[model samples]
Target: MRTDWLGAEFDGVKLRLWVDGALSQRIVAGSPEQVLQTMLADLPVTDRPLLRSGWPDAALTPVPSAVAVAADQGRMPGLSQAAPADLMRHQPGRIRGFLTTRPDFDGVLCLIGHSTVWAHLSAGEVVSFRSFISAELFSMIRSFDALPAPADPADDGFAQALNHAMSRPAGLAADLAGLRAQVTLGQSDKAQAASRLAGLLIGAELAAARPYWLGQEVVVIGDGQWDAHYLAALASQGLSAAQADGVEMARAGLQDLWQMMQAKG
Candidate 1:
């Protein structure tokens, strides 16, 4: 039964498809609409399968607008009602991922991706939340020639920098400038520089988001070195977070949505 449905994910630059337990991916060189149309044309199916869009505002083109799936339409037992229109427009997939995986969690969910979200949940409903673009900033900084790569999360420099940034987020600019000076003076290596940079950014983010997870049972979901950094940083502050696979959470979210639609029908 699972093989009867095709799962497609487009993140602006790439398109990934899963069918019959097989995976296929390609660079989205042309308009997403064209790419999706082409892919659909080649599929060996007769009837049109159910279509699900992560959100109306996704980078993927040709999706139904927000008005199409009104808040009341996607309600479930625990995750009844979609997120606010603005938040839904930005992080629908991540919110869906969290809802599907930890709907009844009574604490906070820290979803790490290009943009990280810290959402407080109680009785399977979102109470309050905040979003951070720290990861995006980290990526942008790492693109510079001075810091061409990120350091391993285990590096001592990373921990020290994280501590420093969390303790005094206001000093971030000076600290960053100091790193540049150290690098220019040949006082720091690339690995140490990168680690410190990442630590500083993440630490500042954690500092700003302290109220969200200060005394809550936290679960972190993501799949990347940045995610590992988040876990390690949280551990540094005496907080332990359970981890879940982001990919699995997303698939589960979509599955839940499908079941909800079937039930409605």
Candidate 2:
């Protein structure tokens, strides 16, 4: 089946296979269901073949995380819907995925992406979480016709602007205007202006998220690209963070859920 479009927008559809409850293989394609169905058609028919679906985090509201409160591990733990009503978007899949790998984790998880999420976890459950749109905001701002293209990776504008924003958040509007003026007046180059814009936005996010990260062990989960920026921002505040692979965490979480399901049956 054709699966080109899957790579066009994002990583193509992901498929995981299990035989007798043991993960066998994983596949990525533009159309995973179609591919899976084709493969299954050639297999010997079985009356009890189990077809489990991947968790769809986007379509569902995030439930406060839960873990087995007892030794059996497969036993269901009571969950509560305690997420604040204002947090419209999040990736609980990532949160669950990370926790499954490190069940004893106790701290704040900063999952950075288009809609970054900061979740507080304690005693093997998610205490609370808040989401921010800093990445999306950066994309939107960078797309303006008058703005410069994104800066080079080594640019110092990001650091300089971040510090400015962290110290003088109230001047954010003026800072933004200054960036445009700098770009328009030929004082700052394209890369410099772009980097500075990113710094300002990220600085604002760090400021708002201070309550989440202050005096807490932070583990940042993300694809490598955006992880560095958030890490740098945290480091500026004298905080150190550990990094984890976001994709792997999600896969592990799903695998854990699959094992739990098999145990119950």
Candidate 3:
């Protein structure tokens, strides 16, 4: 039987199709509803859709055979009606599990999305987690009349600010204030200020996540740009990390769960 999975992240939604134990196709859409609509449009009468809510707000309207991904320690109010009893709030754990399923895997795992950071130990335990107001900040910053556009990934301003934030996590608030001051006085461009603000926020997360990252091997999973920022930040601490595509990991996780269900049946 052909099985399709639809999942949502902070940035967008993704659909993965698996047929007879092989992945056959993948699609990306702007929103969960749009992705689901697309899936339904072409869905065969014999097929059912599986949904995994990555963020807090990713639940589709109830449909027959629609299953949700869940975590053991958390509740996804969005997926409450669609998820199976055996599947629970173990997303962070599942991501870690998928990473470890690879050969010779051992280390700390970091999942950095648009507005959240999840750090997990090699033992499949969550060490630290946080959800920031990144979208809110971006919206607020965009509303400014004179601020420069967001910084490019190649900007030294981003690296420098990220290093500074990691080193002085306690000064985050002060650093943010300084960013505004610099921008207001024309001492720094909008791009530089924006980079510094991001640095400050991520730096704080790195600080809190020190226990998981201090001496462990780390791997990052998420959007390429955000992953790069996190990799650079970790490198600033003299730490090295491997990178994995978040979409692939999400698909792998859903596949793993689906196989589990099939086995039980």
Candidate 3 segments exceeding 4 Å error: 1-39, 55-97, 103-105, 124-139, 142-154
How should the candidates be ordered by lDDT, best one leading? Answer: 1, 2, 3
Residues 102-221 of candidate 3 have per-residue lDDT tens digits of 634556667655354444433343333344445346446546635554566457887777678778888877887788888889898776777766676767777777877788887887
Q: What's the lDDT of the predicted structure labeled candidate 1?
A: 0.66
Candidate 1 Cα errors over 4 Å, as ranges: 10-15, 25-35, 38-41, 56-91, 94-98, 146-148
Kindly indicate the candidate among 1 and 2 with the higher TM-score. Answer: 1
What value does the lDDT take at residue 135 in candidate 2? 78
TM-score of each: 0.80, 0.72, 0.68
- Assess candidate 1 and give its TM-score to the true structure: 0.80
lDDT of candidate 2 over 1-265, digit per residue (tens): 3211110011223454444433334455556556655555664434433323332222323445453322123211222344365342224545666887788989999987767878888987777777777777777777873566546434688888998998888898898888888878989876788889878988988888899999999999986767888888898889999999876664555455545555766
- Residue 213 displacement (Å), model 2: 0.8
* Whole-model lDDT values for every prediction: 0.66, 0.64, 0.55
Native-to-model Cα distance after best TM-score fit, residue 244 in candidate 1, in Å: 0.5
Best by lDDT: 1
For candidate 2, the TM-score is 0.72
